[model samples]
Target chain A: MKAVPAASTVEVDGEYRLKREGTSLQWNIADESALEAALRLKDGDGIVTVLTMGPAKLEAALKELLARGADRAVLITDRRMAGADTRATAAALKAAAEKTGPFDLILCGRRAIDGETGQVPGELAAALDILCVSNVERLEKTETGMRLFRRTENGVQELEAAGPLVVSMCEYAYHLRLPGILSMRRAKSKTVEILTADDLELKTGECGLKGSLTKVITMEAKYPGLRKGPKETDLSKATEQIQAMLREVRP
Target chain B: MKEILVLCPHGVDGGLLSKAYALSEGNLRVLVLEGEEQTAEGYGAKYIHTIKTTPPDEAAFAGWLAEKIQSWGSTIVLAPATIAMRNIMPMLAWKLNAGLTADCTALDMAGEDLLQTRPAFGNSLMASIRSLSTIQMATVRPGTFRPVEQKANEPEIIPESGPAETGKVRELSFTEFAGGKPLSQADVIIAGGMGVGSKEGFEKLAKLASHLGAGLAASRSAVDAGYAPFRCQVGVTGVTVCPRLYIAVGISGAVQHLAGMSGSEKVIAINSDPKAPIFGYADYGYVGDWETIIDRLLHLEEETL
Candidate 1:
């Protein structure tokens, strides 16, 4: 799923603050990497469907994913779904998956750029009752099962997983192929199926901001006074420290 | 009398136990696997349960653990917010229908309710969360709390039965990624971001990294823009580095990106945007054109040659 934060809401001075009201109507690059990875795994077979749950205006983002080679697209939009937290959002997306698939595999971007929670994959994996691989760089097929090269804190570890698993791709793990004119034309012609709370049977009271586990209490801008680090303006001194620090670490 | 249980199969960080102790008022138990019994004992946990289980069947563990939590009537479950814990805890949370906060930076007891503070929207916003379900669960971040010192008195060690559903999934073989030095171990790092412009732009930073014998890193935008490899990316979604010196070029700092590298001993940043968040974190700030600043650095190197 692609999410854009309202850039205009950002207020930067000596401090960092943002109002997440405006949203960009485009694909999140991390999710786009996952989409591209899904295509690579497709390997001239299997269908790739892109789904996003948001307001009615998010259809365009789904269409863009379609142009990039998704076989089908789903726009699961409902007012009741608004302001859903990570758990609720994962539940809604998982429920949408149920409606669209008895799918053998599910792929997601590492984390949403907006939320930066990195929670949905595990939550969704739990929701679907499947093995969730959080950090995969590459994927391969085996005779009995599939193999994935997963990134760990130290290095990448290869793991064997079967279908009916959810995997989230690391950022820039795979480069997305540009949509050709033919695929773009087909995407333009296709009618994106829309699913509502009625279609998914989502309980209104069970979702939205009210259903969320957390709440933002207040906001403030960061300030110069807040920072205690001594700022150096001398390039020569900075360069010397860099060299000394390098020697210290390498030695 | 242990109502709070902390699962530390992957050993334990001081922050995890310190938070656990603070919330439970020094009355919490730690759980580890059989071989890790001594390691958990060193952490000064009053009661440590070392389960004799070894299968990596997370499903079985989740089920067994969830059942155990219900039976014990444990109100709070804490795990290291590392990727390893993340893999299994959410599954457990799902099974228990519990509310869980990921990467919780703060955990406090407010009249029996756990007050959890976590970063949201790429650290652009902070959200205080509480679990509404039967059990409140949270994954605490590392380096936030100090490690409990090992005491002379030994902790009580309880041997636990392995999950019955184990051995369902077996490990066949293994191959670790054969690659260059990872960002986490690098002494000096040169990180890039969207301000680097394109592939051509990133190469300049890479050249400097090579010259300085430093590892290369990128903010989320650079990786998303295809200017750098995913392995070299550094941010909330990428690897964290504790490099002695971190030089961020054309990188606007985002909280997500800062989460990964804010621990660097010293930082120097060059970005065109005067108000770029990178400057706030940097020890040395250069608010100017990245291209021009980079060219000058390269020219100085050439002159020294």
Candidate 2:
């Protein structure tokens, strides 16, 4: 394997703190699908980096990435970035990515579990002016470029594109690899670089509360019906009921 | 008292409109936009604002909606989380600079804010989000909210005139899938996945669907396997459904598949593998060969009925 300096970050409290100081291979929470695909490609000795912006409590997510196979981690911690909408969060990530430098691939999950808008990848791609492929299922490193299998409304589509690309990986792309004992041991000693507003040369208006284009006006909890424990039935009876119900509905 | 404005799309299903009305509480004024005559009549909202359409475009629609939002001084806006609605609502939200929660499975009036609950992280977790802005917006998933019964005999309708604009994405042509029924609207669904084995196996599932007077649906894997059409696939990439009864046969319930039909009133799964993920969420599960079980059920149906 070519030695590409990798960099990844963790968002602690809300700052993009970099791990591995100056290394190239970085892994962060790529919660967008298209971004993940772009990052999985095997490019020449060029470093791969990942970064995330979230609360200090999310260190576990960052650590998990390291255990899986990331080179380093950076944690971005600050209170100002809390409860940020997509635009604000994307801005923070964009700022961090710009500072990380000369990256060839950026990967993210197609949509974060918390916010399923599926907009950040496209929005970030727009910000970076890079090509983005969303909902990618499989990614392979090609000799000339990267080949990707993306899921669509119709079926899986295969595409070959050249780097500096940003692709998002679908949830089903691969079972997140578990960190082996050796990798976990190494990650335990690995130092993470923490970044804040000062480290990243971001405009005050573009960083946190001020940069967000939208705001949440109101919030109310929804009460989906009460959860009942699993209902148990014998196979024969269950099968009979299913048959009867189908017959009644059909007849 | 704070005034909240709920924006119901012009031609949404009457069933969906009823649910939207039920969700409304004190001081929440529901405004149904008049898009098509059929939709307007079915919705029967107290306030119906009509916009003339001559070749619709995003700019014209945005202009029309912006004028109304300003005039009404609406606080909150609600729309169905469908592809069509999602395409337009984001632009509208951007124009208004309002925070919008998309694909909200649950909505409730929590003090001053609307507590929106939606699935996050591959449907493994649920997050409750609140907007901290003047105009809170949300797009609710269809079939999650229960439509209320119509109380009034005739609902008041208001019509307004405005200039129509051209649409950004022009519909050059439209083609409807030739199938049993659209899975999203189906009351009963018979869906299959990779476990169905072959094309001949899929035919059996189709027969079961037809016999049940239900729509035939498939998982993404089934579609990938070429056993079903893309439109009939049910998942994140396909259609989300809240059918009355969903029967999954020869399919292991992946989170993607569950995301589409988890809201069904009843779910039954037939798989030989007892540990299949589908059994976890199923109301009833049979740990046996699908072919044997389905053949038995079909025979039972014939003998009994």
Candidate 3:
């Protein structure tokens, strides 16, 4: 699970990247749902490990996941991994998966709230050379594999995958449970495992800005209103105005 | 010469094809997997390529396209950002060691580079990006571009065949979303948010929507609150809509919600909060009780008819 900038706390600098220095972070909403699904599916002996790639500041957020019933937490953080685009981020994540996983399934939020690219899960699947399913609204563990219901624009597609798979979970499919006082206390002692570029055996050239394939040319703040000033009115007048607008559109 | 490769994996939306064709500068090679060649030609495709075998899933299709892209030697690729292509394009880009911009709102050529523009930071910021790799790729939403006028043209048809990755994920069933007209296509949308209060409140909104021949849409909070269905959701996490008129009731106009409906031609906001962000986006604002407003609107519609 990734800790992204809270929507309300997002601040973009004059430079290309977001200004993360003092911005607050929260578990991505879709990722929380992904984590909830994992927690629910885990059997008695099954372990729910949460992995995230970000700066060291993300450790606190990972511990929060540990408090909320995750068995383990791993943070893949390296100075060299800074400014990694989706592809390079996938490369680093692929290495971490190899280091810590031989698991049956991988779950990711459909997209990061900040980038809103919705591309990492597919790129990660490619990097790991595995099958990927996205926009999955529901999942059930089967004897051989897993059955998933994916929400598309027009319909719901029910699919079954037999091998290792990457699933990009739909937002709020499952609400994440909050940690109890006892669990929160116990979670403080559990250390979050850290992995660096050297630990993943990733080359310097294949990490961070150097490894990224895309560059942000510019960023412009999108102002909210097209209308310079709205024609504010009472209920009666608003109703008339709406009627006029409706006629203009419908007629 | 390097050509603009538009991947119409499924049926082509003419708008997407025409827009790509215009950007292609008469050098567009359309790769249609399960789509029609005639549709591509109708939208001004000159060099049409059709896949012989349909790949089972996005993973298999991406594998096939990656190999074909190398052989075709096209540097720039565009596809409609449907669910399947959203999955396929990234994997294809990864395989080609390329950069891919997702859900691009705008596309242009910066010299030889494909300048891709999209909403970033949950629609608060618009980012313009470019790929540095050998191949440049981007996926555009289906209706963001308008279809060019259809014209009669003779097009070269090329048949291509490849091995597909098979027997991985099996499709069991598909259920088409049923009910009123889809939110994206609706000319007028009556969207409710958290203040709708309950499922019953949404039903009231639905009644008003049906009365007006409009579609019912909901904010993410409304969907989360179970006041509305996921299909009716409009936001960053939901469907982006560009209706001719959008009537927002009780929506606070979170940036996420605003992103989806920012394309609306005109907006009318009905919220109790006088200072709601939604009022800033609205062409007309009414700070009052939504229930009273909805009831009045329903009565007004009946009388107007």
Candidate 4:
């Protein structure tokens, strides 16, 4: 799970990337839903490890995840891993998962609120040589593997898949549980395991901006809903005009 | 000239196919997985390769597509932003060591480079991206472009061998949601926001929508507040709709809300706040209580009926 800049607090720099410095951060809502799914799927002796890739400041966010029932927290951060696109980011994540994993399931939000590319999970799955499912809204533990209900634009796809696969979840699929006082206290004593690029064995060109294949050419502030329309504060006139426009629409 | 490849997994999205045709400038090759060759030919694709899938598998499909794309000597690839493509494209990009932009709203070519434009930062910024790899890829929004009205071409249809690798995930069943006309295809939409107050308020809007023979939509705030379901939410996270007429009832237009419905041809906003940002986008603005405005509109509709 990653702590993204709050939607309201998102500000773009001249280069078109989000200015993450001093920005208010919150759990990417979709990732929180994934966390919720992980928590619910935890059976006896099952551990939910919350992992994220970002700067050193993200340790606080990981600690908060630890408070929210995560048995362990992993923070993959390094100075060389800045400006990584989805592919490069996935490469770094794939390395971290290889170093610390060999687990049953890996869950992520369908897309992050910031970039919203939603390509990381698939790329990471490719890097790890695993199956990946996207747009999964609901899932349940079956005798063999799991049963997943994936919501798509046309219909709902039902799939029976085994573990050792990556799944990306919808934002509102599961509501995250809040941290209890006792859990918060316990979380304070736990140290967040930090993994740098060197620890992951990511080569010099395969870590950060240099590793990314996509480049943002330009970014412009989108002035949304810029239609020139006449306004009327008069209730009677407004109703009359709306009635007229309604008549024009083909049934 | 390098080949521009388009993938039609479920079928050829006419709008997406036409957009690819425009970008490729008549030189287009399409790979249809379980889609009809005639539909692709109608969009003026010169070469169409039809392939069958025993089961949908992203990893296996990506590996196969990567090899095919390389063999065809294609430099750019485009697919509709459907669930399957969204799942498969990233893996394909990884296998090919390519870069991909997701849900691109616009596409252009700048001196052999594919310029992909999409919303960034919750639709507050528009970013134009380019891939540094040999092959550039993008999954476009389904209905972002208009379908081509051109006649069919005598395209060469080849049957390609399917992927041999079987996936672990097994398909069970698919349940298609039954409803009236979907909001995306609706000619007119009556959308409500938080100012609509509750589920009961959305019911009122639904009544008006039924009366006017229109679709019902909701702002993200309304959906988040539990007044409406995510399917009805209109915003960046939800579906992007372009309708002939859109009515914003009790909606205080946030940029996120506007991102979804801004493509609407005509807008009518009804909010108690005269300064609601929705009014700025509306062709007609009414300042009053939603119940009062809805009641009047319904009364007017009833009288006409």
Best by lDDT: 4
CA lDDT, candidate 3, residue A22: 70
lDDT of 3 by residue, B155-265 (tens): 898877755558788888989875556676678999999988999999999988888778899998999888988878888677788788999999998867887898788
* After superposition, candidate 2 runs with Cα above 4 Å error: A1-83, A90-114, A119-239, A247-251, B1-4, B8-10, B13-16, B26-44, B52-56, B153-156, B161-163, B210-213, B229-240, B295-305
Better of 2 and 3 by DockQ: 3
**Candidate 2's residue-wise lDDT over B97-151, tens digit each?**
5667777777777677777777642343456777766788777776666554454
TM-score of chain A of each: 0.84, 0.70, 0.88, 0.89
Q: Which residue pairs collide, candidate 1?
A: A6-A22, A15-A222
lDDT of 2 at B37: 37
Q: Model 4: per-residue lDDT, tens digit, B1-305?
A: 45589988667778878877887787889988646888888888889998886355677888888998898888899998877898999999999999999989899988899999998766667899999999999999766787885577788888898787574788899887544566876778999999999999888888888877788899998998999879788876776777889999999998678878887879988899988888878887778887877888888778878
What fraction of the correct interface contacts does each predicted structure contain? 0.36, 0.10, 0.71, 0.78
TM-score head-to-head 2 vs 3, winner: 3
What are the DockQ scores of the candidates, in order? 0.33, 0.11, 0.60, 0.62
TM-score of each: 0.80, 0.63, 0.90, 0.91
All candidates' lDDT scores? 0.72, 0.61, 0.84, 0.85
Candidate 1 lDDT by residue in tens digits, A18-120: 5344435556657777888888778676899888877788777677778889999998888887877777888888889999997877888877655666778
Model 4's alpha-carbon lDDT is 0.85
Query: Which prediction has the highest DockQ against the true structure?
Result: 4
Better of 1 and 4 by lDDT: 4
Question: Which candidate comes out best when scored by TM-score?
Answer: 4
- Order by DockQ, highest first: 4, 3, 1, 2
Over A1-251, each residue of candidate 4 has an lDDT whose tens digit, in order, gives 87788777655565434465787888888999999999999997898888899879888878888898888899999989999999999999999888887678999999987788899999999999899989999998899888899987656899988758899999889999999898799898999999998999999799789999999999877656467477666777777788888878865
